[model samples]
Target: MNTTSQPSTADRAFNLSTWLVDRHVEEGRGDVVAIRCGGESHTYRDVLDHVERVATGLRAIGVRSEERVAMVMLDSVEFIATFLGALRIGAIPLLTNPLLPGRDLGVIIADSRARVLVISHERAASLDDIRAGASEIEHVITSDGWADFTASDEDGAAYDTWIDSPGFWLCTSGTTGMPKLAMHTHGDVKATFDTYATQVLGITANDRCFSVGPMFHAYGLGNSLTFPFAAGASTILEPTRPPTPQLVADIVTTEKPTLFFCIPTFLAALTNSDLPDDTFASVRYGVSAAESLPAETFTRFLERFGVTILDGIGSTEMLHIFVSNTPDAHRPGTTGRAVPGYEARVVDPDGNDVADDEPGQLVMRGESSASGYWCRSAQSRATFEGEWTRTGDLYTRSADGFLTYLGRSDDMLRVGGEWVSPAEVEGTLIEHASVLEAAVVGERDSSDIVRPIAFVIAAPGATVDDEELTAWCRDRLAGYKRPKRYEIVTELPKTATGKIQRYKLRR
Candidate 1:
């Protein structure tokens, strides 16, 4: 708990994965559980053992610190070991969602230019068709079902050759085009942990944490993996897809976690479940990120679970949460305030600061911001303007500094010279009794003009027509802000990390 005396590692540059190992040594938590995956548990000491073996194995396969290593596996102990092991020797570990289809995976593979691939046996077969044409990849390390491969003499030895540089590469969600790989230095990732975990989450050794988010994403990587590990806290890591309320309920019931991190959609689903009282009795703090959390879900989370849902805004570029609302300062719908060592501002189209209540593009410059995109000269130039990273999110800052997310900059709609935020319309629509979830997009009108159209997902067993929904929006929103049309569907499209894919709806 006494973080005051220890000198900051901020200036002492290091790779993210190796710094984690240093923390484990300093904290003397080698015997503590570091990862709990699919009912299997591994201690910090166990993680260290794997790191040595994998680092040696990778070296035996001719992988160097500057070399690229890609992993396509479910969230499990092996995944963590392989990732961190690559880091131990300064190898750049490129992580991607294993559930991605062949076409998407092929694009990422080409983009990453990875020479080595670490994947599970089950997912390995799916690459049979793709591997025929993949000449760049040399070694294919399988976790399961490959029993014939012989271990090298250096398999369990340490790889003493270490280079000091960034540790990983992650492809961004290319909603606009092919995804660009974001280069997160080991130092950047560690900075996120120090700022958010120590300064924002205020975690301690006794806190039991659990993350439903996928580890490949920034949120899960920092908070679920790095933060908890650095703080000496234990986390439950289950490998699953679209974790439903039923699955979450089971995890909460059995794990008895104190802190829970999830997205808004998953939280809404949990609140809608018929779970018994005290189902989340052990949970004292709940954190939501990856997507905007509706006020309705926040209220329901508190009312039913008796724990405040602290919503924060984070991105892959920022490494993790740079703005957060902790338990002490619970702003129901806002994205809270910026973290220490960081500054944020809302800017208009011309790059001038906007008024307190005016919505503008959210621009931030900080220590934890990414250096730049990998290999994309044009993107790096556009995204990195000096030290600032122009976050594409649109937001309005209140007088008290709480950030209200309007939507993504590309998500804003302009119709008849009036600008509108999809979040504002979606927020109003979800407040209606019949709507469960809502997404708003700009559609072409009969005049070939652009206008806001809302897609509504009705609550279970509730049947309300589009006419009624449009009227409801009209009563709650301004004439220009009201939805011109409505599309009723069972659910909205979402990314693997649970963020709404608004671009998909636009198509």
Candidate 2:
């Protein structure tokens, strides 16, 4: 097992930066390259140097312990350094999605009451509006600001923050409303690394990690940042916030990563794109989360690139994947099993365990689960119940351990006296040769009955024929499960991490 700095209940210093950034250098792996981004390589020693600079920079700007340091930076060397740096000096780094609009960003800045915002040059374009709304911002650190901050000689003794102190905050996609912060402690990072990254991936220093999912998302946080860093492995940071298939293809071909982390939507795009069969030739495994991977997408990508995708479900509250498909137990359509150190149960609305094969809300109890959402008392209580975190996703567990995704609790459509899983319908729709991506939503018909409606994005050269698509679904899905109407769209609305925003389609 990979060794990491363990946490304790005693009042001891347990900064995540020491474990993820400084430990490698302390252990004589300083020469090992920790990160590769924007055509530059940073060794563990170099990363530590960057961490020190960020720490000193934050100090120079009077950032004290437990302060919120909002980071709106792109996926680059500075992102990891800044995140670790904040942890090093006992500040809470709030990671925001760079693709979020100025208004949402402004709201987050105000909500968190972040005094310092470390942003990229491109994202700083709307600084005026964001700053105007969030007067709490005392300092705005950019590239030029970073250069000066890092170059400065200002330094301080590393703060000995408690192990249970809020280490970082990840913004929930705000699918329901404005984004809320999921507060996780320093120990949470190590917990995810040990359970999912260690037991599942079995990553070693020789492995190279590349993820298309932006670091802001929970899956990507574990996949690209914590997983590799804790194992002393190298991670590839793609600066392109929303990476295109071709762009990702080029990175895989060039970076030659051993482990590839991506979402199902982008994976489908890569499979459907005209990219070469060996586009993912160097990837030994593809880790997928954020949403369920359709069986067709799983099979197609595997047949085309010889890369097996381990599709799993994780949440912001849970910190990372609590259940997943491992190498030995991978099933194309099922979420394999509860990850080591985590326990999962499918329970009904009343929190009673449903019989196997009965769909219910998934609740996970794990050490990596976030403490709770910051400042949302009612929501925090509702989502995080004592030791368990309710995922709000619908799933059916088999008699044994295999679990199948049904869809979100709200996403299950009641149609024609039977429940229809949008995932099941979407899976069938994407199986059609012409369909690239599909989203199924409920719509009331003329008879005031809820029916599934399909919105689809066509494959590269294929045209969406209503009849042909209907025929494809007709053969596969049940009469009630089939989409009542099909609407061809240019693109499905998605979050920055590529989770399909079904609410938008519903709207």
Candidate 3:
């Protein structure tokens, strides 16, 4: 392993694809298992061979350096190979969710101006609609046709000579508005591996990693692909859309992973499922991100299983989790202190630092932070100010350096002239025994005053009345923080990453 400090930018240039993919082959660890998917496994050498062949194929098709290649596929070996392959040949890969609506996908493809698109057969039917608007896409390839394109034995450019250029592009979750592509560099990739994965998470070659989030999302890209590759660790990929608890349990039993990456919604489902207590007995770490883990969900997960989840906060711009909880030093309700090499602060609207325990917007600076949003100059200027990126997230920092999420600044509701954090109200609602999940949003009343309204999913076989839930909240929460009305629903609308779409509820 290269234990030496990272080379100074002025002294040497490096490509992230070469650093992550070629290093294993160079170190003679090619025989080790690198990826496990669909009951099959591939060694590091196999991955490299595939990557080189794909790079050759891309080059043969006139994919020049810095050209954009977008991938709308599942979390499978093909996706991994294509992503690294594009980077290996000096092309920028755009990681996109395949399940996006056709209109949204067209908008993103048009904005990115991607030259080639790799999608699954199931999604190929939407190409006509997407291409009508995204005229720049010159070629489209499906997973079934991947082998035909990469059937050559042509050698790709040597890793040593690969251009040290920008890394893959990731779009924001679009929780606030239309998603923008965030441009990340190779330096940002290495920084995330060094600070978050190696220093904070302590991932090593012996640890088997499994991720529940889709690889298209930044959280999954780092947790499942980049971090494991950096450590020469094995990663398990479940290609099933909306993986069920039984599938996750089966993978845990078969793969025997030491590390598990997940989100709060999945954690809640697993906790409520009939899985045995020992399902996670072999697991060493349970990491949660992408959204705040409700305190009730955290407690329930710990009680149902013997593992404690390390909840953290990260953004697409940051590449990976910069503020996280180490397994040894975790606080249940708070996202732990900042990971090494990163700094965080809570500041008011005026950009002044707020006092401890005061709610304010979270602004962070780190080595892994992205350069800026691609092609969105105005948004980039508003978000990236000098060294810090304005997160638009509302949080409170304790004197002890722990961070507690309140809600998004725009998601906060003014009820009776007092600001109410929807997260707080939803957390309180989830604490009730009959509530499985809850989302709080602001609704205007007859007098044009905003009030808190809750949408809840009841526990299985547990009948919950709106009046009962309102009374339950009244008992535990203050007058202003309690929801004014409750609506029982079978499920809440969620993003692909499992975060509740609060905006949909407001509409």
Given candidate 2, what's the lDDT at residue 319? 84
Q: Say which prediction, candidate 1 or candidate 2, comes out ahead on TM-score.
A: 2
List model 2 lDDT by residue over 366-464, tens digit each. 998899889999999999999999999999999879999989888889887789999999998888889999999999978899989999999989999
Candidate 2 local lDDT, residue 345: 93
Candidate 3, residues 278-365, lDDT tens digits: the string is: 9999888899998888888999998889888989998899988988888778887788888989999999999999999999999999
After TM-score superposition, what is the CA distance of residue 1 in candidate 2 from its true location, in Å?
A: 39
Whole-model alpha-carbon lDDT for candidate 2: 0.88
* lDDT per residue as tens, model 1, 1-507: 766774444545455555566568556778887777677778878777777677777877888867888888877777787888788777888988788765577667767778888886667765864454445777888887322232445654333432226768876765554567888766676677678788877888777788888888788887567888777778788887767788888988988888899998788777777887578899888899988888988998789889888899888888888887876786888899988777888998888999999989888887777778888889888777888888899999999889999999988999789889888888888777787888999999779988998888887778868888778777888888888778888888877878788888999
Model 1 scores worst on lDDT over the 10 consecutive residues at 155-164
TM-score of 2: 0.97
Off by over 4 Å in 1: 1-15, 22-27, 132-134, 145-151, 155-164
Would you estimate the TM-scores of all the predictions?
0.93, 0.97, 0.96
Model 2 ranges off by over 4 Å: 1-12
lDDT of each: 0.79, 0.88, 0.87
Residue 236 lDDT in model 1? 85
For candidate 1, list the clashing residue pairs, or say none. 16-186
